[model samples]
Target: MINLKEIKNDLPAGIVVFLVAVPLCLGIAMASGAPLFSGIIAGIVGGIVVTLISGSQLGVSGPAAGLAVIVLQAIQGLGSYEVFLSAVVLAGAIQLALGFLKAGSIGYYFPTSVIKGMLSGIGVIIILKQIPHAFGYDSNYEGDVHFVQPSGGTTFSELFNAFNYITPGAILISGLSLAILIFWDQVLTKKHKVFQVIQGPLVVVVLGIVLNVVFANGFPQFALAASQLVELPVASSLNGFVQQFTLPDFSRVFTYDVLFLAGTIAIVASLETLLCLEATDKLDPYKRISPANKELVAQGVGNMVSGMIGGLPLTQVIVRSSANIQSGGRTKLSALIHGLLILCCVLLVPQVLNMIPLSSLAAILIVVGYKLAKPALFLGMYRSGWNQFLPFVVTVIAIVLTDLLTGIGIGMAVAIVNILRNNYKVSHYLYKDEKSITRDKYRMLLAEQISFLNKGNILQTLRKVPENVDLEIDLSKSAYIDPDVRELIEDFKETAVTKNINLTIKEIDRTTAPTDEKALL
Candidate 1:
């Protein structure tokens, strides 16, 4: 069952995903206020351990940006990163329960517009948050959630500070990386056979690292120091490394605060993973539907491993998954390879990785951000109609102004309103207007379920019936009806004589009806 063809097809995609993953893994961990190595550890576990268990052929799991705020807050609130890791481990167990309970289908209930909006919103957030980091401003982390700066400054002002305080080394490396990334597809893509095999991002990363070394000696100008690098936890042995992993302090498990936080993390992470899975599936040329419950289980496993080994919880990240798809990944093999690469790099080449400029990573993220929030994406959403545009725009605005959860809430609200607006329609009818019973009117009748919204139209029509006019209020075909509408009908039936209607109520269970026939006519 191990498909070599699938593995072969995934090589190109694997390489690109590696380029994208390396910087992001570090950035997200940095954002979480956790050790930078924690992210790399999560990535390795997600790619290698989770991939083996996941039902998805193409999904790539790792520490999620959506959880950055949660992780950071949890670390502070819990008073220790180790305590938060305990929560993460517990969260994984909860996710496992959800998987077994078949809760993954809940994702289907969310409208496509809301999901698209979420992706677009996250894209905007990534770009906005990364700007300062790209410019080499280390004053704040890369994933601040609030629209305003931590010290009450605006995004622009904070960005201005970064620009004014710009490190020359950061600017050069980031600028060069971005330039190469921007034109990689246009220039290097057209090169001869061997050069063409290498992707633009890979070349750019390699060049950035090389340039970093060349300028490392006398020109400390180009070299970012160890302070700027990913700090691995102080582990002198494998046992110590394993010991650095955390478990949730079960003493806090029963607390309302801890439960609320756990629920929040579980719900949000599940939704995000589902959305990423959907997007990745869409990108798959083979159009594979990843068994979502299985994905939940795999993510749970990854998070358990991550939490046990001093890492952040995992989700099927859209950026990494998208990169995986774009890179032509055909199987989980690419994920496995990417994970192995992270582990190998960590074990063997931490010194080399520490030299990577934050700017270069920023450049890579900027490119990814542009791809997600491109003007074309906005226009495409607009053309898709208000159903898509309204929620998408709301999500983008709310996220930019607030945070991820707030934006998602706004977008979901818009999506629900749209669904109700589009689905429920009403019209009035009179005793003599049987001719009006066309397809449009019949649609309301045949609707398997009716809500209170249909009551007004039904009441108005019943009131206009001529004296002694025959009427049939049919429920035989209706699968369900709301109590408000039922009560209104009952009241109208009791007084039908005044409206001059001889009405027949069909298919209502006699046992469910009152003994007073007049009360229900």
Candidate 2:
């Protein structure tokens, strides 16, 4: 049975995410050089449309920041945004194919260390990119590239520029919103159950909107222009709005550029969705497992709807999912509600939403960035072991130095190098006591397929046997014997003879192992 308590509980978080998503949807579309409404439409479709089909309870789908670079490049390369939309539709179809094939198990192939590295890298990137915006620098874009110059020199230069030319209204709203968000948590921490359940961010967003309304009388608080707000395409009637939908250019569906674009979208979007699902599952208090294949299908449907309506590509975004989980979401219903909220706002309250200060949203993202890239996160990764630590640090450094995909690739390479250096291979060993060895002295068993790295441990364990102990070494189970282990065993046997230790050797030659045995290995 569906639990109404769980649905009601998600309202606070869902509303907070809605506030957070508003400016982000607009900003991401602006950064991608797409129509501003496209991002909002994507968010709505991702939330409402995808939620119906998704197996993930907490995951919230929306336009992704990672796709901004690709979308921008596709538009430029295709010489038209409409052509890019055609590619998006084809990409959606491809994603559908991937879902039906149940290809999500591929996500499991990523080592835990690599996935942790990726999460930390994204966290660091979020913090770095949002710094300027938090300080009232909306000149460039919200999710700007790490190294790319923003018409200025560097990221720091643009940040410095914002401080020099700060807008008072933005500064006021940002400071107020940040203070409210921070202090709300502190107060809630001290309060009893009822207040604790009420999230501070939700209150801050509602207050921010209300404050804008109260101060709208000839005040600069409502001064955000169309450039800062989500700009919906104006139509004469509801029918005209429906008529504004984009259709795929089937003529070029199989063109080389379209195919490449489709592949790019499918691959990257799949990675992001899977990663978000894994992370969200880790974050789930109840430890719920999301179905990856179903998620892909849901996202495919969302993207198909988005692309057809001039919206950006969609994915299961960690940012919204984290907020959803933190806010107390227990099922997909919260996502559906949030999407309806976006649609309602777009249809009825676009004017009032236009007054929301960019700096206020920046402040919200700043807090989110802090939560993701906190000092605790670094310390936690450090404690997880060098296998995890190296990749986590490398991913963060690479992303901060380059971009997302490039950084992930470098981290994966580093992880593979570590795996190779450690000689990660499987082996099995069996010990036996033969009648001859029992009548004699010491006996030791060695298995085939043993690599050189296991030499020290295996040798040390065998060396503890007493001189009179009988030993029977069996190699029948081994399929391959490394020269190193063979030499070590030979030396040990010679030493056993001098010590009066009984040594019996048996060899088993087989081309392949038994099926059950192979599975154990």
Task: Return the TM-score for candidate 1, rounded to 2 decimals.
Answer: 0.83
Q: How much RMSD separates candidate 2 from the native structure?
A: 5.3
Model 1 pairs in collision: 13-327, 86-247, 86-248
Candidate 1, after superposition: displacement of residue 145 in Å? Answer: 5.2
**lDDT tens per residue, model 2, 152-270:** 47655666677786656556667788898787666764776676567777666566566555556568554444444334455556676566566655677788998899889988998
Q: In candidate 1, which residue ranges exceed 4 Å CA deviation?
A: 31-33, 142-149, 187-196, 216-264, 426-446, 460-477, 494-496, 501-521
User: lDDT tens string, model 1, 1-521?
Assistant: 23566655566667677656766777678778887778878888988999899988888888887798788898888787776776777778888888999989877776777777766776777677678877778666544556765577876677778778777777787788888876776576666544445666666667777776777866877677664444444456677666645554567676676667767777788878887887677667888888889888888877777887788878998778766765557788888878877777666666666656666667767777777777888999999988789988998888778776678788889888877775454322233444644321211132457787777666675665556555667676565788887898789777867755666676767666557756667
For each candidate, what is the lDDT? Answer: 0.73, 0.73
Q: Kindly report which residue stretches of model 2 are placed more than 4 angstroms away from their true locations once superposed.
A: 1-3, 149-153, 193-198, 210-240, 424-521
